[model samples]
Target: MSADTLITLDTPTDGTTVSGSFDAKGTANSPEANVPWRILDAGGQKVLHGHFTAEGWMDKLYPYAGTVDVSKLAPGSYTFEVSVDDPSGGEGKAPQKVDRSITVQ
Candidate 1:
């Protein structure tokens, strides 16, 4: 039950100038068969959300990579919450989360 998944968002600028992507790496983790992720602003607003399939179980591993767009968002701090969904397994054992604050200004 060791799924070490990593989600990263990169914004090199401020306001509408900032834009980047989200990435995941499941190889080193417990190999998540299926998982969902969501991006939120500082005010707990939903910005973006997505899910992944465990198609490449053997070769790909768990930590997969994804992308997002944050340029249109206003200048302020934000947060991200990634939820795990493994129908084959139970709850709490599959989900993983990571949080960070960023300023668009």
Candidate 2:
């Protein structure tokens, strides 16, 4: 699958600075409309993770929006990533993922 067609993040764009809670909004086309996400510290250590369902799926890309809280995390740079859920467990092609850097204050 083409990387560009897999997913797109619209809010909290790259190099953004956020505090407390922030919105994560984007569009994605993946199995069962499942959009899994994670936050990693600069050292590449996972800090937060979870999954959220899209508004719709199957025929085309659907919108997904959710809130991520960083109030408990220490102030620093981190990576926010969203990946397509591949239930095939590698039997199919590799999953697609998109990530961006952000600074938490």
Candidate 3:
């Protein structure tokens, strides 16, 4: 993913198989700091939830590095995403979500 995008998952690229816990580093940008993230099962249930932290997150592009904890999940397919909250309760501005599918072993 490019630094200019809204968010990017660098490790465990899409459709990659993995096991246990692994490093998950990516870049994200929100209208604010610390955009939330989650790992979802194939059924779309949230399994792991967390947020991204950057040195600076002021309506600009930034990097968020963290580990994706999947040690407790059974072998299956899941998805991960980085999301941003809606900028106020107004029209035309809604939450942003980006996701990719992965396999667990």
Which 10 consecutive positions of candidate 1 have the poorest summed lDDT?
A: 8-17
1-105 per-residue lDDT for model 3 (tens digits): 555567666775788788988777766676666677889998899998987675456576677777777889899999987776446755665566777788999
Off by over 4 Å in 2: 1-4
Name model 1 segments beyond 4 Å from true.
Answer: 1-18, 22-32, 54-61, 86-96, 103-105
Report the CA-based lDDT of candidate 2 relative to the real structure: 0.89
lDDT of each: 0.49, 0.89, 0.75
- Cα lDDT tens digits for candidate 2, 1-105: 454587878987999999998899998987899999999999999999988789877778899989998899999999999988889988988788889999999
Using TM-score as the measure, the top candidate is 2
lDDT of 1: 0.49
Best-fitting candidate, scored by lDDT: 2
Model 3 misplacement above 4 A: 1-5, 86-92
> Across residues 1-105, which tens digit of lDDT does each residue of candidate 1 receive?
334443322322223223354344332222455446666877688887776554445343444455555667676666654544545557545445544454444
Q: Candidate 2: TM-score?
A: 0.90
Task: State how far residue 92 of model 2 sits from its true place (Å).
Answer: 3.3
